[model samples]
Target: TEPLEKLMPIDGYEDMPLVPLDIAVEPLVSSISGIHIYAYSAKERCKNPPADDLTIDESASIMLYSMDSKFGNKSLHVILNEILKSADKNKLEPWLLYLKLFLTALSHLPSTRRQVYRGIKLDLSKEYPVGETIVWPGFSSCTTSINFVQSELFLGSAGPRTIFSITCYLGKYIGNHSYYSSENETVIFPPTQFKVIDCLNQGNGLHIIQLQEIQPCFSHLHAPVFSSISKKPSSKLTFNSVVNHNTKWKQRGVTLTKHHSRGPKPDCLYLPYGVYVDDNQTIYIADHGNNRVMAWKYGATSGQLIAGGNGSGFNGSGCETNQLNKPINVVVDRRRNHVFISDSGNMRVVRWPCENGTNGEVII
Candidate 1:
C-alpha cells in the first residue's frame, strides 16, 4: 500500500543486490485478481527471522512483483489496453481476430511468390511467340534497264528521207503528228526547209539550236522553250516562238570518253542512284558494271577509283577492295561527310566516310 521505499535497508542486508524501489512494487501493480504472488528471497533457509515474518500470500505477491518488474509489464500493459479498445470499437469477434492473424501471416508468404511466378510466365511467353517472315518486292529483269537518261531534245536533220519528225501517241490515240505541221509543236529553229543539228540548254529559257545544211551549214538559233508543260500551238502553219527564259537545269559536269572498243557502243551509261556533286564539285559514279565507284573532279575527263574496281566478288581494301556486284545507287551526306551506296547484289547499304575510300561500313 505505502511506497515500497519505506521497506528498504533491512538489517544484515549487505549481501542483497540493490533493487530500485520503484521496480519493487511493479508485480503488485500488475497482479490480476486470483493470481498467486511471491516475495524476493536470496536464502533457502525459511527458519530465518525475516522468513518467519513472511506470509505465503505476501511472499507470492513479492515474487510476482519482481517478475513483472524484470519484464517491464507496465509498457506492455499500455499497448495491450490500446489493442483491446480498438477491438471493442470495431466489434471484432474472437473468431475474426484469429482469422485475420492467420490470413496476415499467410498473405505475406505467397503474394511475393505469386508475383514472381506471373512475371516469369510473361517473360517466357514473350521470349517464344508466333510470327511470320516477309519477302519484299524487287526488280525482276535487266532488259528494261536504261542507263544515263540525259535530257531529251528535239533534233532536226536534213534530207527528204530524214525520219520526218512525227510525234505519235501509243496509248489511247494513234496517229502521225508531223513536227513541221503542228503549230503547237515546239521547234528550236524555224522550219525554213533547213535541218536541225545540235541542241543544248543555254541557261535561262533560251536554247541554242544549230542547223545543218542551212546553205552556210552550222547556223545557230536561240529559241525559248517551255519544258515544264507541253503546250499545243493554235496554228498548223506558223511555228509558235513562245520561250521560257527562267528554267534552270542541273549542270552535272560529267563527260564520258570511249576508252576501249567494247560492247555495242553503250547506248547509255548507268551511274549509281543518289550520286551527288559535293560543294567542291566532285562527282562520285557508282559504276555497277565496273564494280567500282569512280571519283571525278567537275569537268574532269578521267576519274580515280574511289571504291571497288572491275572485280567480281567480295574482298577487303586496295586493289582487292571487293567487287561492287550490282550497286544500284550512290548518295552522299555532306552534313555527315559520308557516302552511301546501295549494294543491291549484297542486299545491303554500305557507307564510307568522305575522303576515306577504302574503309567502309554497312547500314543494313
Candidate 2:
C-alpha cells in the first residue's frame, strides 16, 4: 500500500542502518557493568520449592552410609519409597546427617529420659496445609531452629514444679559450624510466664507458634523434685518455703529502683513506665512523673540523666531537643545503638543516637 520511495527505504533498513566499519564498537562484555540477561522459569512461582530431588547415585550413597542394622531395613525401605515418591534430595542428606547428630545429642543429654518412642508413620501430602493468619507486632524476624528443654526438667520453689515445658532458640548448623544471622534482630520472651496459644506449620520448613503471657500460679502437679533437699519443715512461714508458690528468680522480691525508699532522686525513680536493658546490663528507665529518662550503668548507685529533668509537672512543653513531656515506653535498637521513647504527653515519639545522648530527634 506504500509508495515506491517508502517501500525502498523499508526494504533497505538493514543496509541503511549499518554502522561504519571504521568505528570501534565496544562489546557488551567490555563495559564496567556488564548487561545481565535472565531467563524466566516456572520454579520461581513456588512457595516451598521441592529442591531435594537427588540423583540415583547420591541416593545410593546415602543408603550406603545408612547401612547400620539398627536403622532397620523397613525404615530404610520406607525412606527410599518416600524418596521415590517426593522426598526432596537437597533436604535428604542434611536431614539424615542431622538425624544422626540429634540421636548422638540425645544420648549425651544430662537428664535421664523417663520414656521414649521409636518412630511414627510418615504421611506425605501433595501440598502443605493452609490456615488462619495472626500478626505479631513487635517481632522483627523468625529464627531457623528453636530448641527447648523438657518441661518436666524445670523445678520451682515449694518443690511443686508448675512449668509444663522450657523451649530454647538456637542457630542451624552449616558444615562444622552453626550460623546465626546478626543482620536481623532477635526477640526475647519473658521466662516462666508464657503459654503457647496456637502453633501453625508454615510449610516452608518453619513453624509459627504464638505465645501468651500467663500468671506463674497456673500450674499442674508434676511430681515435685527439689535440687536442694532438706529435712527442714515445708511450711510457708519458713525461710525455705516463704510462699506457697515462689519463683526461682534470684531477686525474689527486690526492687532495683528505690533500694532505699520511693522518691524522685538521682538513685530512685518516680512513676517509671518504660524500661530497657542492653547486653552489657545497662538499664534505661523512662521516669514519667519526673519528666526525665535515666540511664543507670551496671551496679551504679545513681543514674545519669539522658533526656529531660528540667522540672516536674506539665507546666510547660519542652522547647529544646533534650526536653521530654512524659515518656511512657522505651525500646532499644541494638544494631544501630539507638534508644527510642514514646513521649506520651508530648504527643510524639523520639530517638537518640546513643544511650548517653542529651538531644533526641522526633520520630513521630
Candidate 3:
C-alpha cells in the first residue's frame, strides 16, 4: 500500500454527508469482522462528550476510532490508515461512510495548541530532513507525555527510539473521551503536515526530531464548528492538570504571600479588593486600605508596588499620581503593558505602567 504522506487525497470521503454511528461504520463490519461490536460498545461508552458541537452519535463514532483497538495483531487504526495512504481511489469506497462521520466529529473538537510527543522504535532521522515538510495522512496518534514514551510500558528505555517533538496547533485532544483516558492521547487528523525543524542523534540509538505543524495552502477538511464555544463539558482534563501533578487533589497548600502577613502597610493585604493573575502568574492586587496595587510574580515573597503606594507626601490625601486613594480594583492591559487602577476614594480611574512607574494618569 502506498503511504498517506504529503496530503494524499482519498476521493469522495469529504463530500459524503455524515450518518449515525451504528450505520456509518457498518460497511467496515463486513471487511473488519468484529467492528460492529466495537462500534456498539464505543457508542455506549461515549453517550456524552465533554463538548457540545458534536452529536452523541458523532462523538461515539469518533470514540470508536479513538479507542485504538487491537485484535489479532491488526488494529482498526492501522487498517484504516493503510488504505488512506493508498494512491488507488477505489479502495476508499468501503471507508467513505465512516470517514465522513469520523472527520465530522473531529471538526467539532477544539484544536489544542501546544507541543505534543510521539515516539517510534526506529532511526527514521534520514526520512525527515531539516527544512522539509512531512505529512501523516491518517488519524495520527500522539501523547502529551514525555515520560510515557520512556516508560517500560511503551517504547522502553534501551532501544532505537525516535522521539518526535511536535508543535501542533490543530490537533484534537481526545483523552477525556477515549477509553484509554489516562494516556493523554491527542489525534492529528489527515492533511496534517509538518516542517522539520531539526533532527539530531542523541547517542546510543536515541534520536530527537523537532517538527512544527504547518497549514496547507488550502484546507482539505471542513472548518471547525466548535471553535467559538470552546468550553468543554465540566469533565474535560486541562493541559495544566495533565502535565503537572496536583497536590490538593492532596488537600494542602502553603501560603504564597509572606512578606508582611497582615497589616495596612506595603505588601500587606488590608481588605484586598480585586486580584488579577497574568499569563506569567503575576498577581496584581488592589490593596484597599493601603491605597496601592501590588504585583507579585510567581514564587515571590515581597510584591513590587506597580500602581499606587502612598509614602510621606500623599499618605492620607493620595492625590499624587504616584499614590492612590482607596484603590479598590486593579486590572492589567497586557497588550498596552499597563495597569488600570480604580481609585475609589478619589473617585477616579488611573492608568499606570505595571513595571516601574512612580506616577499615574487619571483616565476617568
Best by TM-score: 3
Q: How many residue pairs of model 2 clash at the backbone?
A: 8
Poorly placed runs, candidate 3 (over 4 Å): 1-8, 47-53, 218-364
lDDT score, candidate 1, position 64: 31
lDDT winner, 1 or 3: 3
lDDT, model 3? 0.69
lDDT of 2 at 161: 17
Candidate-wise lDDT, in order: 0.31, 0.36, 0.69
> lDDT ranking from best to worst?
3, 2, 1
Per-residue lDDT tens digits for candidate 2, residues 1-364, read 0011101001111111111110001121132121111001111221121112221112222222222222323433234323322323442331332222222222222222121111111211112122322211111122222321112222112221112111323211111111122212122111123344454543433334444433434221121222111111111010112112222336554345544224457886754655666666666777765777777777787987877775432323545667776565667677998878767656578898655687888878
Clash statistics: count for each candidate: 17, 8, 3
lDDT of 1 by residue, 313-361 (tens): 5322332234465454567787888777766545467787667466567
Give the clash count for model 3. Answer: 3
Q: Cα RMSD to native, each candidate?
A: 52.7, 29.1, 21.1
Model 2 clash pairs?
52-88, 52-89, 52-90, 53-89, 147-168, 148-167, 148-168, 151-165
TM-score-superior candidate, 1 or 3: 3
